[model samples]
Target: MASLTLPRHTGFFSGSLPTRPTLRYAAPVKVRMSLSESGPSIAVVGVTGAVGQEFLSVLSDRDFPYRSIKMLASKRSAGRRLTFEGNEYVVEELTAESFGGVDIALFSAGGSISKEFGPIAAEKGTIVVDNSSAFRMDEKVPLVIPEVNPEAMHGIKLGTGKGALIANPNCSTIICLMAATPLHRHAKVLRMVVSTYQAASGAGAAAMEELEQQTREVLEGRPPTCKIFKQQYAFNIFSHNASVLSNGYNEEEMKMVKETRKIWNDKDVKVTATCIRVPVMRAHAESVNLQFESPLHEDTARDILKNAPGVVVIDDRKANHFPTPLEVSNKDDVAVGRIRQDLSQDGNKGLDIFVCGDQIRKGAALNAVQIAEMLL
Candidate 1:
């Protein structure tokens, strides 16, 4: 018989957001409030994309206070209709002029779009919480994961502060940190080795659609579509499609290393990662190996994760069940499992674990909203 150990966690962790948050849509927005009426005037910069759609869902789920909200996208998407907060909205083409009178602009457009307009929005006094890599590495721009580093963005708030930009870390980085940070706080991680199984959703809605179309085509004995990826992605796994750096690490992998360093505000920690895009539709999974400066027992680690905010423990050894992307889809909390001490290192100084989270929700939109909430 296989060894089976139920998570059996004792308590919850602090310094985190709500766990298992529901993502149901809000009732149709009955009335449209004006920017001058009350609450903050908001803008969704990439209102038609995947993460963009998620931003709307999260905003409604949390009942984020807004006197008005603008759905801004590319020229092509202008005039398209989207419903939110019980109200119907026509998408507007984002431009230099869109940020006027907007209080908080949630940006989910591609890097180029964010690169151009993020600064513009900030210059116009609109606080921009950008969900792209565009400004994450900018020293002056505070990269934030509200659960882990809210203070990194201290002094900025809605309605009362000068316009500034805050960068949301990559989805993989966010999900990993949600689980790892609690443990790191206790054990002081000295080195980290991560292997990721990413989902098509990380690529974009097009990539996700391609996967679905290709899967159907493959089942029907047709040639699989290969539009979004260089290779068939429906039922096959491949290395992350990000450009390879001189160090042989892909951009996605490098983001894990660099972002972890910045978010933790710890420059001396050693980290490495190998990222692969699996056929999963929505969430990302990671196998994280850690070497800690202090001893951390496996049982104690489980208890810490159990109590940690925004972390769900699913380590079921008897049933051989653990965190899966399917279970975490559209969920707010990151699920952690496979916790065990690394026998390779003496003195209980190392351990291994698995983590999964919805790339679009906690990894992107929900996270951005959480940071925005802290400012209020």
Candidate 2:
């Protein structure tokens, strides 16, 4: 993959990350998205990370508002320069005291960083929209997907000095629900089996670079680099790298099972998933088999999704066209295809569908930002 050519920074903004004055990105030739001025006081936690950078892009793309904004990361990332919306801002080290008077904090750091500072920021009256697994299952926190269940975080708002936490569901869960939820609203889903083909972006930017580097090394007849994953990732697919639990499911797979029940707000729903890591650069694809309590014909399900928000259908049998990760990269909508009735089930109660979505955008950054938008 070719690297993006970005403008060189001229200077840096220093001192504790400010929250009152508006910050702007350095001007670049690329078309810039409009920025909203009526938004809350926002902070992007883990600003040095891949997902953290994505948070800024999504915010700009949506023209999300902010009274002020802060760029925060680990100590090592401190003093680094990041340009956004034509303004250059310095990355500041995150600390417990970082969330004073902040209205919303979008957190994408590793679970450890979110685990440590998430609640602290919330205590400081910041609404923490965490993009990690640390608090998804927490009984107190409302796990949310804005398109699917905005009601989950109902009554949470900005300007209330008191803290609140909202957990962003796993990327796979978010993409799956985007298509499945519409159909489910028409006919209740009783059980679902999921098989995912996740891309390298799920592992972060370094892993993406490693995949590209390894592909080159392999093409050059040299040993592939194995820094990110234990095995060679070039031209290969493997079971997800997440740790396997005692229940015979890896953590990633289990997240789909657990998160679905929570997001759907149906404790009785049965879900099983098998997640795999593929060589794709971005977006995630899943094969989902759903058995509904009532018969949901393929045509009716298709119509429901046709009117659904944040979903695009690409199922065209004549052209043999369907949703693919490459097609959905950088797109906000999750694409659904391969919509058909399941033959194995007794009746039309069971159906199978394939879904594809950009893991970095809709799956992570956009979802978090949408949650923040509801607060305003």
Candidate 3:
């Protein structure tokens, strides 16, 4: 119920209506509100996207504390309806004014939209849990994984006129680090060499459809056209998404490298990643080789991972069992298996591990919602 003054800037207004203003707060203040009695009023931006849909599902499944909910999307998706908590809510067009009186806003739209509107939502005294890359690297914004950094939310000011925006890490980075961070605590993670097999869902709804349609055409003995992807996505793998930087790493790969270091707060830790898009619908699997500051045996490394939080160790060589994308799909916990020492390297200093996680849940939607829950 507190408001901050907006600076007079040309970009702050479109035509007649004053556009949302960017707000800055010295510190967060909590207003005396009974969330238990009335629940928190919440809004979801980009409600039509895959991650947005997952956000809705997670909120309902987890019974998040919310009194009311608003669904906002692009003009094309406006008037569409989604059911939640046994009630239907119509999607509204996203605009500067859409976040009025919203207690919390979950953003899953592209980075540009998040950049333009996220600050506006924060100015209106709404806490934003953003699932985009826009604010992840911002020093002021907290990139959080609830299992690893719930304490990071302690610094967030909910209602004191400060726009609290927390960023969720990239899907690949989130899944990989969820399995690796805990192990780093016991043995200092000196370097990480990782390759990712990502699902089509990571690209978005259209990419998923493209993979499906292309697969169908190939099975029917027809020519398959690639649109959502630069090349055929059905029964194929591609190493390109966005563009490859001068360093030969694609944007997706670089995101994993940079984000991993930040999340672990270990700049000295070395990380290299190769991200590939596979034809799977959901879940992402990673093959990781880690070099530790202190030498750790395979059994000891496996024990640390087995007892790690948000991790399920599924290593069983005799039964030929290990974490797979299909098995970990739709699951929240990161699955780790195929634990071994990298004999290719001298000494038992390096460990090899495989991890699988639902890129939609633990990677994006569920993680953002969990951060919100931690704040509550």
- Give per-residue CA lDDT, model 1, range 1-376, as digits (tens): 1111111110111122223213321123233332245678889998777788788767776767887888898987777665555456778899999989988999999999999999999999999999999999999999999889888987887767589999999999999999899999999999999999999889876787677778889989999979889998877999999999998999999999999999999999999999999998788999999999999999999999999998999999999999999899878999999999999999999999999999889999999999888876
Report, for every candidate in turn, its global Cα lDDT versus the true structure. Answer: 0.85, 0.85, 0.79
**Candidate 2: lDDT of 190?**
92
Best by TM-score: 2
TM-scores across all candidates? 0.90, 0.91, 0.89
List, residue by residue over 237-294, the lDDT tens digit for candidate 3.
Answer: 8895868899888999898888887788778889999888888877899999999887
- Clash pairs for candidate 2: 24-87, 25-84, 25-85, 25-86, 25-87, 26-86, 26-87, 39-65, 39-66
Candidate scoring better on TM-score of 2 and 3: 2
TM-score of 3: 0.89
Error of 3 at 356 (Å): 0.6
Give stretches of model 3 more than 4 Å off.
1-36
Q: What value of lDDT does candidate 2 attain over all alpha carbons?
A: 0.85
